[model samples]
Target: MPYVLLAAAIAAEVGGTTAMKYSEGFSRLWPSIATVIGYVLAFALLAQVLKSMSVGTAYAIWAGVGTASIAVIGMLFMGEAAGVARISGIALVIIGVVLLNLGGSH
Candidate 1:
């Protein structure tokens, strides 16, 4: 299903972003390579989902989900700050994604 593909794309994007944090300003070879691979896969899957989805809706969902997921990953696993402002921003991204889905036609 397209939704499944979309989810995969989001996961890939999130993974790529997380890898970026560990890439040490691109000095690390492996993580940097992984980041490139992840992003390539993400864009490929996202393109597939876009075939039948609206550009606005698909991009919004992809970016929102990817951002929220990476934020959680950072808070839970990475030593990133779990401050109220960051959490609130992530919540807003999730809520905005949900609202976009609700407002769109199937």
Candidate 2:
């Protein structure tokens, strides 16, 4: 399904972003490879989702979810800061994504 494809894309993007942090300017071969592969799969899956979803809707969801997920992953795993303000901002992004999806379904 398109939604499933979109979810996979989001996950792939998150994985890519997380790996990218560990890539150390692409010096770490394994993580760098993983980052590339993950990004490729993410885009490929996004293209599939675009076959059924509106470009605007799908793109918004992809970007919103990918960004939020990556931020959370970075905060949790990469020791990146997750202050209250940042968390609130991420929450707003989630709210916006939900609204976009709801509006798109109608």
* Number of the top TM-score candidate: 2
Query: What overall lDDT goes with each candidate model?
Result: 0.91, 0.91
What value does the lDDT take at residue 75 in candidate 2? 91
Backbone-clash count (model 2)? 0
Deviation (Å) of 26 in candidate 2: 0.5
Note the residue pairs that clash in candidate 2. none
Total clashes in model 1, counting residue pairs 3 or more apart in sequence or in different chains: 0
Instruction: Write the residue-wise lDDT of candidate 2 on 1-106 in tens digits.
Output: 8999999999998888888888999999999999999999999999999888998999999999899988888798779999999999999999999999889732
48-92, model 1: which lDDT tens digit per residue? 998988888999999989988988998999888999999999999
Cα lDDT, model 2, residue 55: 89
In model 1, which regions exceed 4 Å deviation?
Answer: none
Q: Residue 7 of model 2: what lDDT?
A: 95
